[model samples]
Target: MDETSPNIEADAPPALDPAQQSLSEALRVSFGILKIVMVVLLMAYAFSGTFSVGSNEVALRLRFGNYVGSPGQRVLERGTYLAAPFPIEQIVKVDTRPSTLLLEDEFWFETTKNDSGLTRSQLQFQKAGPLHPLRDGSLITGDSNIVHAKWALTWRITDPVAYLTNIGSKEVAQELVTLTSQQGIVHSIARLTADEILRGIVNREQMLGLIQQRLDDMRTGITIDQVTLDKVSAPLRVMRSFDAVTSAESDRARRIVAAQQERARILGETAGEASEPLLDLVNAYSQATELEDPAHAQEIETLIDTALLELKINDSVIGGDVARVMNKAQTYRTQITEQIATEAQSFSQLLPQYQLNPRLVMTKLWEDAREQILTGDVETFYTVPGQLELQFNRDPEIQKERQKEQLRSQKKAQEDAESNR
Candidate 1:
C-alpha cells in the first residue's frame, strides 16, 4: 500500500468488459432521446396556448385563471396571439357582433271545464271564448284593461372586457339582456292602457328607449339596438266584438264631423244672405227715431217686414234655424202692430180738433211747439206797448217780396184763364 499507488488508483479509469461497454453506450442514447422528447412536449405545451381572434371577435387573455390586462388593454383584436402554455395563461374568444333574441307571449283562454290554460292548438280545437285570468299573461293597464303583447330585442356587445368579465359568456349575456328587456317592456306596458297601445297613440320607440336604459344600468356591456313588437291586441276570443265596437266608434266620429260641416255650411250661407238685410233693418230703426213723425212709421214697419222676409227665405235652406227666426220675427211683428195702433189712437184724437177749427188748432200747435223748444232757461221776447222793440229778423223785406210774388202768381193765373176762354 504505497501513497503513489493509492493516488494512481483514484486518478486512473477502471477497465470495462465488452458487455459493460455496450450497456454504457445504450444509456447515453436513451438519455438523449428522453431529453429530445421532453423538449418536444414542452414546445407543444407552449404552442397549445395560442389562439386567434376574428374580425368580429375579441380574445380575452387570463393568467392563472385571472384576467391579465387593464380595462382598455384587456381585449385582443383580430389577430393571432400567443400566451403562456395552458394552466399558466388562458384565452377566451368572444363574439362582439350584433345578435338578436325573439320573445313570444301566448294568450290563454278559459272554459267551464278547464280553467288552468288553453294552448293555441287546444284553442283551435275548441270554440273561441274569453281568456281566463289564470292562463293568460297580459299587461294590466292603468285603466285596468288587459292586453297581450310580444316583441323581440336586438343587442350587441360594446365593451368586451366588461361583457366578458361581468357576464362570463355571450350566451349568458344575451339571456341577461333579454331578461332585463322583458322587465322594461312590462314596466312600459303597465303605464299604457289597452286603448293607447291599440290605437297607436303610445310611442313604441319610447319603449325601446326604456329597455335600453335598463340594459345600460345593468352594465352588462350589452347595447340594445331595437325593440320590435310583433303583436298587440285583445284576446282572440273577443277580437270580433272589439272590432265591432271600434267600427261603431269610428262611424260615430265620422257622422259627427259630417254633421258639423253641414251645419257650418248652412249657417255660412244664411249669414251671407241675411247680413245686408239685417244691417238695413238696424238702419231703419235708427231712421225711425230721427224722423220723429208717426206718418213714416208705416214705412219703417214695411222695411222691418221685408228684412224679416229675407231672413225667413235664407233660413228655409236649413229647417232648424229658420223656424226659430220665423218665431222671433212673428213676435217682433206683433210688437210693431201694437205700437202702430197706439200711435193711430193719438192721431185720431188730434184729427177731430184739427178739423173743427183750423186757425185755433194751428195756433195751439204753434204754441205747443214753442213750449217744447223753449226748455231749460230759454228766454222769450215779445215787444208790446212802446217798449224798445227787439227785432232779430233782419230779413223782413224778404217776407214782403214773398207777398208780392203771390199776387203776381194770381194775376198770371187770371191772364192764363182769359187766354183759354
Candidate 2:
C-alpha cells in the first residue's frame, strides 16, 4: 500500500516543491491583503465627500457643474454633509457672516503710501501742484463742489446659490460690492451740497439702500448691511475755506438756538404758561397789522385783552409779571376812587355850612387852616404886634433841629432806595 501511495504521489505532478508551495501560500495571503486594501481605499474615496458647514457659512453642492438636490435643499446650512467626490461633484462653501470692506482713498485725492502719515498741511505742501484729474478721485456735489470721502461697507451673502452661481467667490463679490457702492456714493453725494457732506449730513442709510438695490439689480446675491462715511472733506486746496464755511454755519445754528432760548425765557417771565397763546395772539395781531387789516388786528387785540383779564381773575392760573402789574393797577384805582368820593362828600357838607354863615364860616375856616399850617413840618416866623424891630438871626436850637431833620430825610431816602433795589 505504501509503495502504491508513493507511486501515486510521484504521479501527482511529482509532488509540489517546498519553495513553490510556500510561494503559493504567500501569493494567496498577498491577494487577500490587496483585496482588503482595495475595500479600505474605496471606503476612503466615498467618505472623502464628507464636509462640515460652519455656523456662519452655507454650503452648495454641485454635481457635474450643476447644483444638486431641489432648489430649497441645495444650500446646506451649519452641519455635516456628503456629496460625490471631485470631478463628479464640488462642495462650495459661502461665508454668510457680515463682511466688512473698507474703501479708503477711492474718492480721496491722489496720494502715495508715504502720504498716509502726513498731516493736512504737510500733504498740501508736498502736493502743491495742480490736481491730476485722472489720478485724483473725487465726487462732485450738487453745488458743483468737489469732495473726497472714505467709506466702509458691511455686507453678507444672503442667497448662497445665487452668490455661488453669479458672484462665485467672496473676493469677487466684495469687488463687485465695492464698485457698486462707489457708484451709489457718487450718485448720492451728487445730490447733496458740499457743506452737507463735510458737516456729516450724509445719508448713509440711503446710500446703503441704493447700493443694495444696485446689487439686487445685478443679481449679485449680496445685501448691504451698512454704508459708513468714515471721512469726507473738500479738496486740500479749498479745505480751509470749507472749514470756515462749516464754522460759520455752526455759529449761525448756535445763535439761532440762543435766540430761541431767549424768546422762551422772556415769554415765560411775561405770562407764565399762558405765554404761548399770548404770543400766538401777538404774532397774529402783528401779521394783521403788517397786512393792513385793521379789523383782524383789532379782533386779536380784543382776544389778548380777554386772555389777560381771565388770567387776572382766575387766581388758580399761574400769573407772571403781567398779572402782577394788573393787580397793582386795580388796587391803585380803588384807593384813588375812595379818596375822591370822601373829599367830594366833605366839600358838599362844608358848602351848606358856608351858605348859613358867610363871615363866621370864613373865620372858622381861616383858624382851621392856620392850625393845619402850624401842625405841618414847615418853618414858621412869629412877630410881636408892638415890636418894630425883629431879631433877624435864627435860634441856635432851631438850626440844630433843622440839621437833625435834614439828616433824618437823607437816611430815609437811602433806606427807600435800597428797598426799591
State in Å the error of residue 36, model 2: 5.9
Top candidate by lDDT: 2
Q: Which ten residues in a row have the lowest lDDT in candidate 1?
A: 312-321
Q: State in Å the error of residue 404, model 2.
A: 14
True-vs-predicted CA distance for residue 293, candidate 1, Å? 35
* lDDT comparing candidate 1 with the true structure: 0.72
Model 2: worst 10 consecutive residues (lDDT sum): 312-321
Candidate 2 wrong stretches, greater than 4 Å: 1-48, 82-88, 112-118, 203-206, 288-298, 312-318, 338-421
lDDT of 2 by residue, 144-243 (tens): 9888889888889899878877888777887898889889999999899987888889888888888888889978888888888898877888777777
Q: Which lDDT tens digits does candidate 1 get at residues 200-255?
A: 56566777888778767767777888877776767666667777888998999999
TM-score per candidate:
0.51, 0.74
Q: lDDT per model, in order?
A: 0.72, 0.83
TM-score of 1: 0.51
